[model samples]
Target: DLDDPARVLRSNPETYFKSPEEMYRLFPGREEAVERTLEIAEKCALILQDTGVHLPGFPIPELYRNADEYLERLVMEGLRERIPGAGEDVFTRAHYELDVIKRMKFSGYFLVVWDIVHAAKERGIPVGPGRGSAAGSLVCYALGITSINPMENGLLFERLLNPERVSMPDIDVDFCDERRQEVIEYVIDKYGKDNVCQIITFGRMAARAVVRDVGRVLKIPYGDVDKLAKMIPGPGVTLSKALSTVPELKERYEQDPNVRKLIDLSLSLEGLARHASTHAAGIVITPTRLLDHVPLYRTNKGEVTTQYEMKILEEIGILKIDILGLKTLSHVDKTLRLVAEHEGIDIAMEEIPLDDPKTFELLQKGQTIAVFQLESAGMRDLLKKIAPTTFGDVTAVNALYRPGPLGSDMVSDFIERKHGRKRISYEHPKLEPILRETYGVILYQEQVMQIANDLAGFTLGQADILRRAMGKKKAAVMEKQRERFIEGAVGNGIPKKKARTIFDLMAFFSGYGFNKSHSAAYAMVSMQTAYLKAHHPQAFMAAALTSDMSDTNRLVVLIDECRSLGIVLHAPDINSGGVEFGLSNGEITYGLAAIKNVGVQAVRSIVERREEGGPFKSLFDLCDRIDLRLVNRRVIENLIQSGALDSLPGNRAQKMATLERILTEAQKRQGARDRGQTFLDLLGSAGVSGEIPLEDVPEWDESLRLHKEKESLGFY
Candidate 1:
């Protein structure tokens, strides 16, 4: 109120530039054309002076040329402000690139990436060290935003961002696989719910799913259907190629008339959307409310879902931030808890060793079962072969073993580095430190940016433009850049032919380059989980299995791991087993919630009654205490079959046989309790008199008892 607030924006009347159209609109008069052109050229001069480059080509890049001259001038001035030592021409490309960024007002876009990621680190969340071309950013590296320093690594910023091609900077953050979601929730909270959402992705009907579904719908015999399906490789095999790959399926297709029809239908539907799922981590947060920009819906589970998939959302100008859940963070958290309680060191997880010899030994030996993402059999083989000796090796394996990198010539280069079969080379003297770790191969997007800047007369800012174009793979933009790069190299006195060859190499690596920042982040998690599996095997496995109690194979593998570690496990005892798999006195108490045919309501009734009274004294006592309506004889028989009722002295079969007598006694006892006839009911059996009297059946043999327990308990 004290100030003329409106004048702050309106009082810029001291001869600033405006376009002819803009001037006509702002102060429309035919007489003002000469004055407006004068103002515009002066503004353009000021912009060019900031870049210190004589504007030679009529068009440099889109950001370089004519605009509302004042807008162009303001953007150029903003570029000067961003990069302090702006050169006349070389840094002019950078200044021009900065102008593109300024025109787009993407300073805040980069800032948002830093803010959310640093917030996660402040909360002790393990974000990746650096990933992709975002690592090529000196601003990012300086801010600890990206771990790989572009200067040291020779990563090119142009490979990350090119004014030649205007696009959003994509920085993917990696947290421990286990803890990725906590950061996602924080984003939803920071940006309002309406402005933040995870993207949706469709699952295409692949080979195995197609066969199983089609077989079911056709009502084909399951044995024949499954046999045909099994003959086709279930994982990664496509329906188009399955018949070609499997002889048995081919035989069925050629010989069986009905089978051919089923196959035909399955192939038609094979690549259709079988289901919808959230993108693993692609979340777009917007400055304005997102729903105003894109529609929203609730998934079946009631989570807020985005209408746009990853590519479509970006096309509409929404930013996608990947909030990946790293299971390693959860593992590390669980390990730390176990250590604090049991080991008494109270070791904070972050304080644990990154260079522990034992941990590396465990990884080198391929003993990384239940160790984050590296638990896969293939990665385990790589770990053993590489025999990683340091954190660098861990990160290298994380980056290099991925599908793209593994498929390329780089895998051989990486293998040579491990074995010293090929000597590491930086090509030019300056690239030594940049490529030293991965044996002179630029393994990341940052390395691409640094290369353009250091060797090819590109400023860090211009190099970012190059990075963007390469990542986008805009053919025309890359072609122009390729010429520009060769010109710069030849002008710098390098041979054009060699520059072309190097350019070719850069293009190849750019295609499959991973982000070092993200790889480091995930590698840290992989290390943490490996550390836990190495140290506190029992507690870690207990928590891991508890998270996946519904999965039978997971339960069995975890149990086996527990046994290998010398941790004892009790059978699923009805009296002691609670709803969750938990550690009790260094032994795992099996979760009764995992038993077949025994529903949660029944488990809840049994558990609540046991907690209220002492433990169940016998079958009769258990049936008497809980509601039998929920806990039917089938449920009771399941409990007995699972050895959950073994807390009582009699064999499982005996316990099962007595279920009839027990239910009869239980109904009478319930009546006595309901009618307040407890004292007389026990002494004279009056309450029990009216109940349908049932007798106990004969007990089963021990082998049969154990076998029955295995069936219900999933002990196999």
Candidate 2:
């Protein structure tokens, strides 16, 4: 046993650091053991290699020769559907993208994503328009993997997959939050469940967090530790950097022994793994048993996940995808459902017009309360200033509202140019077409690539590499790219000095270049939500309220938004209120499920019994007909307080007075029914038609009623 001190030799135990000489001096006879340990260490070292991606083949129908053929057929069919009387440029772009995808051997990957999206759509699940650079692929657009047409938006396929730099192309899809699992399960069933698993994530200890942890373990005062931690400046600041920048922390560390010890220990333990958990969106699908490639980890809740995180899986060339569940899609789905049910008009998200005058009017007013991505206060302010008119303007606004653009004069300059207050000139006449969309702002990464391709005689793939070099600011790579760009530009009839100037301007703006593909997709969602809110405020606000019914703070904001939109919200009605907030007769009815202490089970029991028989005529009729086990005394009290029972004959105070007797009698009936005894019906029929007398109690005053209502429901 090497661990046995008596059997093995070790350097001085008190010392944390020991030289090789100290080890040999401690045990002259164990020199062979030390050499053997180093030999084993060399053998045990692991170097991860880039073993190219191992994606499983997507199964196409037998009529197709391979994935590429099937994908092409589907793309052509979809293109006809997406664009009636498609132009030559659309066909050329589609062919170019298909060729690139086939060459990259990514046909299977695209088909896999297409299949998932197909399943979601066929099942009536709302999927996002697109996300990330994948939206730039015309093939993705044609295949219905993305709803945004790349050709129409000037998105570059090279941005999604650079042929010059061969890396895995990521396609993250968002589905309705309520049904995201259905898609995941479909994947698991197609690929064996054992071969598919989510990725693990590690939460690392930052400087402040590490200091607090070490201090807590060392039994320091919480206030002292908190003060010291706060003095470390912002997050990710190490103790060494903090000491150099923060004078008080440095002074205390030098003058106090406890502070010195805490800092010393924290420095050693910082950046270590604090905990391991599942990544929120990443899922890894392997070609074979998952354990054959990576170790499997079982979470505390028994969910199987890969021990390696997303980056590690990517580095090792595994097929990892992100299936994001966005609540906005859920809200959109619910809104569309409500519109169809009440107004008999079915609204397809894809069919919503981008140039709806009412939608633009709403966007101009900065009245987006629950609209996706444009609800933030700063975004709202930007919307009012920009007063976007076109879909492209909305996309540009989404891209320009980021910190890098907002912190500079780019946003203001673009605004001025768009409003005709400032001159919009390009670096060269040739650059006009590329930068014309954003008023010569160069607001997208794709624009940076386009300039290189058009002005410098670079291929789209090479242009993508040039864009990456500029974005990363890699000094050596940028120098080479600059020389090539200058030579190419000069040969193409541009002066060398002007070419250099254009390159420099691009480098400066590249840092603020947002992904136009992502912006366009996000704008699509924003327009969809805005369309619903613009035309159907009552149904949309009701759906928005239902989406956030569980969050009290968000509910308050949505309620206020409802009021601002002139949408009246009624109290929950005992007979008509459903589990979710419902639109009833042109008004919003509060959901029974939103009321505190009334669980989904209680709401289901109430709604089912009402639909089965008829409206509850009295409290006894409701309690006696519905299953009382789910709707207990606390649930009944909450219902009474929330005014769901207001439609009945009793007031809030009267309902509360007789709640116990009703529940006791209802429980007796439920227990008798459960035991298969129908003898209770002989006593009397407690059906909806029969009215039960209530204990005569005065109605609660307005103040008390409102207070109790506010307590039962998050808002009055």
Candidate 3:
């Protein structure tokens, strides 16, 4: 009955396994069939053995012996450009990281990442400083794969790649979201297309969603289903847990047979894979054809994808790169371009001063409406409390504003210490240097590793393993790590009790310890956006609006931000507005393509005609010059209603009244031109005369004009 629904419904009522004799007679071959299925499973089961890492070859010149040498040469040259007077410390750190990378045969991995990042930079795509532990590597800084300097930031290379542990060093790259696919295509061309495929991810039905789905399938009322689903409490709460925790759910399950059946079915369906989709940022590039190692399937849009998820691909030794499309990068790229075009000054991202007082001043005021990673309501509130003054403060706040730290007293403690409301003290005097920048609060994973190395006699690599163990909270492993830490500290002449206290503190804080490298990288992006917003409000807001043109809600917010910044927004003008929101005479002009019912082709035609022939003189001039097929009547109507043609000789009401006649005249002229008529012939044509007269009409009322504008622009 549990296995077969058909048998459960079809069995005779009185004789349905009522006794042992009836059960024996019901399914005579059930035991034999089960045995046969087990035999088939045993025969079909295939064991997958671990294979070594497979990375795509870097296209190095034949003069270079290996990728390691090529990587070294690139690093030396990049270092000379990035930091002309970089000293022995930088060289020592770079050489150490290169040794670890070469020993692990990951030199090609670094080269691959560096190549992609360099290509992006050369093509004017904004790449992030870095992400994750990759920012901890000085090699990444030297090779220009990451912009953050590990030596200056005190980031640990072992935290990124530990020689003590044999694991893949994950170096994820962030590119401008608008042009992320272009980078992917560049990579595909460098590596064979068939060798590269995106990874597939599956989504499962959680407890609440499963309950709703099962209830609907059983024809339950939506109100009742929704109430029951809400009763499940928090995320990851199972059906069994909810039934035990909630008295009402328990009562329903015990009293109502229908409720019991529904709950049972939902429990069965919960946590099962509901659908498969592409992983947002994971793409794998194999050394050979991808299909030979993993099966490939086509997405709905016909993009090839691998059957295995990220973890499976990693376990099988395939290199998976996370090419994340970050919208903040797009914002930065657009803002820089607009600044150069409008202000005639090219701003190099790396050359922008990190310690700019104006940027921190904006952050202090919590004026980060569209700033990257720091614009959330909670983060804004936290920022107002912290009143950040330095770049380090910005990075610390970024790390401390996350869920775990915010849920605890860590955020309050950090803020209080930063404002001098609370005394900042370390567990030991030796910890002062490591915790000084963060106000003695263990806000980063790098600090934990540093503490273990400084106070306890542990290598950075061993300290990394301890951090991982504490994060996982595995009881047996944590206990062993705790003993090792204590013994190491005691051997270093520290008292056992103090060591244990510090260990306990480290374990507790490690759970909330954010990656410093990631925080620094993201903080740089946040600072850049904040700096642009404070200094170049108009250009920044225009870029921000263009980046979110498809989202109406975000567009509304950005528009409000522009108004708050005292930057006037002009309506789309046929002669001035580009395909995207652009800066015009120190004001932001609305994008013509952003209007409802208006297409890109239409905007392109309008802009092209205006550019080729000079400013559009009148409605007749626009109609005569533009391709009518691309700029049809509906598009023109949207343009007129949206005030894009306001510079023309007529008001919107007059344009609407005479639109059909204009279209007819424009069509006749276009047909004549297409038929190869001479300019004189065109001039003599009836529709191609000097001017087309409009019907007598009054202008639209203000309220009516606003209403029409709202209809076309999605806002008043």
Candidate 3: tens digits of C-alpha lDDT, residues 1-716: 34245554655657632554455576686756644755897899667666689898778899899998998888888878877899997888788888899999998988888889989899988888999989888888988889988888888898779988978888899998889999999989889899988889989999899999988877889999898898899897889999989999999899999889889999888889899899998899988899768889898989889988888788788888999999988888888999999999899877778799988888888889999888888888888999999889989988988789989999889989988999999878888999999999998998889988988878898999989998999999999999998998888888899999999999999999999998998888888889898888888999888888877778888888778888999878888889989997899988888888887778888888888889988887788889988888899888899888999897889889988877787787789889999777766444445567777899989999999998888888
Q: Point to the candidate with the largest lDDT.
A: 2
Residue runs of model 1 more than 4 Å from their true location after superposition: 1-291, 296-307, 319-328, 460-479, 490-498, 597-612, 626-635, 667-707
True-vs-predicted CA distance for residue 605, candidate 1, Å: 6.0
Candidate numbers, best lDDT first, in rank order: 2, 3, 1
Per-candidate TM-scores read 0.66, 0.90, 0.91
On TM-score, who's better, 1 or 3? 3
lDDT per residue as tens, model 2, 601-705:
889988999999999888888888988767778898888998889899868898899888777767777677787886645254545433457889999999999
The total number of steric clashes, by the backbone 3 Å criterion, in model 1 comes to: 41
Rank the models by TM-score, top first. 3, 2, 1
lDDT of 1 at 684: 38
